[model samples]
Target chain A: MYVQEPIAILDSGVGGLTVVKEVMRQLPREKIIYFGDTARAPYGPRPAEEVHRFTSEIVHYLIQYRPKMLVIACNTATAVALEDIRSCVSIPVVGVIHPGARAANGRTQTGIIGVIGTEGTIRSGAYEQALKQLSSSNEVISLACPRFVPLVEKGNFRSEETYETVRESLESLKQRQLDTLILGCTHYPFLADTISEVMGKGITLISSADETAREISTILYDRNRMASNNELPVHHFFCSGEPGMFKSIAQQWLGEQIDLTPVVWQVPNIV
Target chain B: MYVQEPIAILDSGVGGLTVVKEVMRQLPREKIIYFGDTARAPYGPRPAEEVHRFTSEIVHYLIQYRPKMLVIACNTATAVALEDIRSCVSIPVVGVIHPGARAANGRTQTGIIGVIGTEGTIRSGAYEQALKQLSSSNEVISLACPRFVPLVEKGNFRSEETYETVRESLESLKQRQLDTLILGCTHYPFLADTISEVMGKGITLISSADETAREISTILYDRNRMASNNELPVHHFFCSGEPGMFKSIAQQWLGEQIDLTPVVWQVPNIV
Candidate 1:
């Protein structure tokens, strides 16, 4: 188990950059290899079988990199593919669901939790299962905010339109007596500030991206695979669609936080 | 391999009940077996060799129950004995230091962290090593408060005396520009309210007990050993000291949180 092997991360679109930014910030020494299936921007409305197939293709492609770990940064893919990927891969495979659920379980005093995700993720009931698996008594309320993902993918973070959109989408969730809310979708972290403003100060928003980065650190340390690079390590990024929009969004989102090398493959969805 | 096997946790004294409360709250279905070395309390002042030996003895005794996981809830003991226990045991062995360090690394925006623990833990520099292992740029400030453990073991949580002692012990540390302060010792969580009052709200207190419990859930999930018992499992507790004080403190600290059966072993230190 070489420690210098980069951790591989894959997502359906630029939303996974939320996880990338967090991993870079929390674990500065570890190298990363990221893949964004920009040709397949939103996997939320897709069928489960198609999402699973797309996820498997990406994992097989990224396997060539010999990553020490594989992280399914997209909640939709994770809902359908995390266990399948883990069964096929030898390295540790982590998803965004459990970490966010674990954080919600740990943080919520009232045991009433709210989860917001894409339609595919909500339909999968993965968050409810993950939360209840830890403790049987957690009352889970789930919502699928399909509108929020488009705003994040377009990098439209904060404005009057965005605020109203966020507030309207979270209309019913905020009325519930929940002490903790899990941002089950990786894209949701980009809209956290506006979401928090709409939800008020009482509800704590648990970001799976941030928690997943922390878990990556935990699993790496547990397996004795943590990197010891004294100098800053360079990260690699790849995309399947137009690098122009991907790179523009990536640069605007990551900015100076990432020391990265972009490699646009222009690879379409695998048949 | 049975999912019902208890998780064994040990601390120098009643300080570990903080971890117990969290584990019970977070993963309530899992059974617990607790050991408190109250007779030889305050592993803080002891030599590293003695602390290591004491920890080994408790672990050896707990081995009879065949716990699925072993948690060194005491920071001083964890610093001196975690790797040794991990090497000797087949089950997963967790320490309080690294989880707290990881949480601090994930939470801090300023790259500055503060750690407060017993003399033994502070001298061992476990938190510093754990914190820097993830990110080298983190500036760590550590302080040892020997007076804090005795107060918690004696069931003194909040009072003018407790508040004054906590304030005085953290006098210098509260002045730093740290965005996060790790409760590096298990006993420190008992004094968290006082410590937070003294340190003010800006400096987030990263409780090792809380983070350690959360990590325990993560590792169990990762290993596919999470308990699935629908019934509320009865928990067992043992302390190598007088039953009166131990039971009283535990009862007061745990209150209604624990569903417990206490068994005072009255076993003195091994030769």
Candidate 2:
């Protein structure tokens, strides 16, 4: 409950760095402890039970830090594990799905919204359910872009190949006449530019990453647990696979803020 | 905590209808009980204690409705009475200020944000405090547009005089180079078109009324208290002065939604 306690965030792979970047920018004073199960890489094609267990394992690992809040930054994990983790946790637990859903519902002028996510996220229909829970009249068109996670996992962001892949993946969605599109996967923000280009200027892209970070601020402030630290906070990063690519993407995504503070790194075992 | 119970919303005047409209759009199933202190409109120039008293009186009048939650849909009243009301209420009480501030902080690329509200809200420094709480580096430029609320109460949303008044009032803020402008007052959303025209597309306007509705959805869903009523529930309206002006403004602001449901109206005595 201490204000100085970090907000723990967990994702299947480096894809969750999108949420990390937003948290760093939106809540600068609050320290963070993150876990990226990069050894498992993409959880998109995995079974629900396995994703749930992996999330729980990461939660158990991060709980040792005694974070003020838990952010389930991966949409796949959030679709299955948010309630399970919330039941066990004493502090507030936020998921990527609901925040993005709420933001999209609020911003969407036309109730005909489009959602793009990994196979796991879209199949789970988490975004649709979340959106419907807010407003019943929302007409949701959901598509599973299974190719997206691997592109981000390998750090392939914004290339001719990437653009073509993104363009083809979004081919069907472009014709839906949707005014708002929810990037249902946290990894999607890394490819936001390519997606934006494919979707064109008429559609607004709602990043679950940015919205989740904003929700973290709202929940923390509501609970009176916001950090009052005046200085820049040093954040801790943990990954299950090779640290090289993870560190590079982490640094590139986070930019100057991570440069200001030396990161504490750890590579936990795949449970 | 029955989900079917209404959400009690109170404001200094008709400005809160903006929030009512958003709530209807965002959380349609939930019933609403609104109170507008029209007899003592323009709380901006009043003392904090008097504003607090008027807010408490309306809250008391609305509390008899046995609502599930309370929404302080007035920036001036929220500045002076939010915590006071929260301490005395059993259900969740939401104020208008922080939601707008959070949205602005999350969306601002340059850390410089502008806020426009009633005199009481600006004088209370609630927006700056809320913004700074999320990110310490934010440079907040705030202005109290004392002229804005009266125009809204009188239902003067758009006109040449209104545009001229808005332009002249915002002349100083135009030079600040702010990337985000928070319509910190709930009433400002009524004049959002004029405000946007004056501020230009360079600055994004954050409407507290819309953000507050979004926040209400978030909190209710988080608490597992969302209303499941498939039918549009009827809403109740109360005012301290003549019902003619208040009802007309409410209908015009709420439009088709209020037309679908028969509203129960009351004019409560000023305490």
Candidate 3:
């Protein structure tokens, strides 16, 4: 089938906009359907079982749209729910961790890589496991920057409060003399300036957003499922939380105005 | 299903060893079953319909082993047969072009990229289309280096003859001032030293082998099909043609001993 179905992407909040920006850049001809579970914003502190349930709920809802593929743009959700969602859906599903690990592996000069993400993602050890799987000799250090996400959600990214929080949170990692660091959380890129400022120019930062988009393109092209050239692509955005905030952040990052709808979770269909 | 199946990879000739080397490095725990169509080597010069038929036949034969996924490690086969084979098989299939295009897109600073591959791959215009889809403004220059494959296949990569061939093939691209070049064929990386020398230090080379390996890692990890740690990986190699040269190249490139089995093609099963 020459499927022209929209590609679906989801995250815990606006953090996934990082990935959305890349998808727009890499696959401009393909339409996208994005959902941000901003109402329950931080999946980081939630239990793995609860996170899985919430993510599966979103996936089930997205299935109604008949998306060609699924992208778990949130790191915590990806760590907890990627496989569960993949099994539930026939279409291809992608997560951020492997792409992040691959990028860090390619970028690192000293064989020492550092990753910073939410408490749940860091504790999950997904990045560490992936990096180690790629190269056993790679020394991986993971830290949880619990405060970074809230700072981004509140649009306090460039504020003095955000800078101080980044400085204090990354104090330990700063001493590691690492050559590469992964912004493991999808939302972390918003605070990149502060993070880069504190880490110095020497430490290369790897964002899985770009890598994930490339993987998406690869899957689409190889399947001959890429969108036809005659039609224009339309993007749909939805958020479980306040639409205004999500719209503002998304527009700023994407450099285009987006119409966002506030969507409440409906009863998930039992499969 | 908790799939423990090995990933099956194929190429028209020993050229696909470049991809196999990267897969082994990136996913050390996953077993790989590889088939080299050495008897019908150089799918590049063959007609598209013939290449598709040959690739589908190899894929059908490999499917008997019940592989979890497939990787079309040859550029020509991917250009001609990836979609057809994907539809014929149930498992996920990956190809080299999109990954290579994505890499070149990411690496190019001048928005001008160059691609070198077999005549078939270059003539297919897949890289140009992909690059343009990523960015309509990107300037794409594609060249077919038909002689490079023969040089690698004969184990004459570093010889002066190979250097002169690269210098001559790349003369137009060198003058184009490209900041990035996609080594569009899998066989080309074996001759990377000579190609790089010809292209000069300004052009960054993108090897689809590494990118394809990363995509495989992403697909396997997302599907929860990653191998268990309890089992040690065993590599299996097959060649439709002479095994001696394939074995020599495989061992030298992978820096490990490989046992290559010679297999003659049986009548293909009609799907």
Candidate 4:
């Protein structure tokens, strides 16, 4: 049955909304199924096995909807679970990491790329590896910003203390004299000002979400997954937690109303 | 057993690292179990129920480690899940929304507050409600910039397009003529420049994360949760997704080495 299948977008929390927004913008006619596992967020600190399992569960839940494609909007999940999910699912699985890395690699003029993300993401060296694999000339300098996420989460974007933290965090990267800085973590983009203030106008900051969106566009186009109709798409959201809060936030972030449903997933046995 | 209890810090993604960094700096002797659900991130867009569920799951997962307290570093997650988590867990649950709202309420001269966040977050009206609850004088004008998260996620902090998106998103808010702009979504902080550039120099941007961190410090101090006794606090990272990617980004964002371990959780049945 050639039904109009929805594209599944999953995140640890609302971070994946960035991707959903893009899908709406780029593929306005397609149906979207978004899932935010907000309960166990900040997946960067967890073990790889756990990440994979969590990702698998989410994917399994999403697949029940029979999505045409899956977009792993979370960077931590993309880094660790994308491959696993891809292997497990029959639908095409896409992630944000590679697209961001590729975008950073393309934008760097001096080949000195600076990456900022959660401790787990930074420690993984995914960007560094991607940069290296993409090109030998690009030098990746990564810094783990354990506080940036919290700062942004708390909405401390322009506080003096936030600036101080950004200053302290970027001191080493500033010393490195890099031209491009990759906002490796989806949340790091919220700290752009503190980072830009610290890094100055000479350096460029790249957001992984944007790159990932563009990548999704490419992947969909390549696979003929783009919606054929020109009508506005129906974006469905499922939260394992709270529907009202999710609707409110999704509306705010996407600048549109999204019908959100609650899905009960069977928690698999954890070893 | 006199064993050091781990404090759990959770966010949608890497942004919580900012809080983690502060905890590390302020409570050097304490142990932090930082979880970034990079797999499903940017909780700013999902439904409240999902965010609550995700937050609850993460809290439950973290509680297994027997953390002394929990920090909801992501503003959206905090806005949706804080009270629920607090009710469910014995540990003190701290969220960024109240602190940021309080700060903005205090700083607004015209009693008109402008909030920017991911579509889901802004739509939740959590900040608006919080600001109003704190003081009736505070009139909140919220705008959802769905693109901001992706821009920040893709590390397009200083890109021309990013600036343009910020300008477009703020155009409606500018009409409100508010003196204070609340960086409602944790991800919006990355677009401060674009926001500032468009909003001009007179406007003040409040970050929820910074205020939340400050609040956390205060709470810890008051509750004696702060680390002491000349012992250095150790921060441990857990990711529900990719450890390598999480670690790489952590190194870049937190400016330190984070050992990320995966914790697999059963996706609890959501009804």
Highest-TM-score candidate: 1
lDDT of 1 by residue, A136-175 (tens): 8999999999999899888788988899999899999977
Better of 1 and 4 by lDDT: 1
Expressed as tens digits, the lDDT of each residue in B1-271 for candidate 4 is 1336877889777767766765554345568888887777767678888888788788877888888778888877877777667667666777777767766765567888888777767777888876664445577888777777766555567877887877887787777779888887666655666778899888988876555555554445324355544445567888776567667767876687877887655663333
Interface RMSD of each: 0.7, 1.0, 2.5, 20.7
Candidate 1 chain A: worst-modelled 10 consecutive residues by lDDT: A257-266
lDDT of 3 by residue, A1-271 (tens): 4567999999999888999988877677788999999888888998898889889888887889999999999999999988677677788888988788888886676889999999999999999988987677789999999999988888777988888899999999988978999999999888888899999999998887877887787767655677765455889998897788888888888899886888976653222
The candidate maximizing lDDT is 1
- Reference-based lDDT, residue A137, model 3: 72
Model 4 ranges with Cα > 4 A deviation: A1-3, A154-161, A242-245, A268-271, B1-271
Candidate 1 scores an fnat of 0.83
TM-score of chain A of 4: 0.89
Please give the interface root mean square deviation for model 4, in Å.
20.7
lDDT of 2 at A67: 87
Model 2, A1-271: lDDT tens per residue?
Answer: 4369999888988878899888888988889888888877688998899899789888988898888889999999999989888878888899999999989999999898999998989999888888887788899999999988888888899889899999999998888878999999999999999899888999999999999988888777667788888988988888877778888888888774343222233554444
lDDT of 2 at A116: 92
- Screening candidate 3 with a backbone cut-off below 3 angstroms (N, C-alpha, C), the clashing residue pairs are none
Q: Which stretches of candidate 3 lie over 4 Å from their true place?
A: A46-66, A89-91, A105-111, A130-138, A159-164, A177-179, A200-203, A221-225, A263-271, B53-57, B60-64, B106-111, B130-138, B222-224, B240-242, B263-271
Candidate 2: regions farther than 4 A off: A256-271, B256-271
Query: Between prediction 2 and prediction 4, which has the larger lDDT?
Result: 2
Steric clash pairs (candidate 2): none
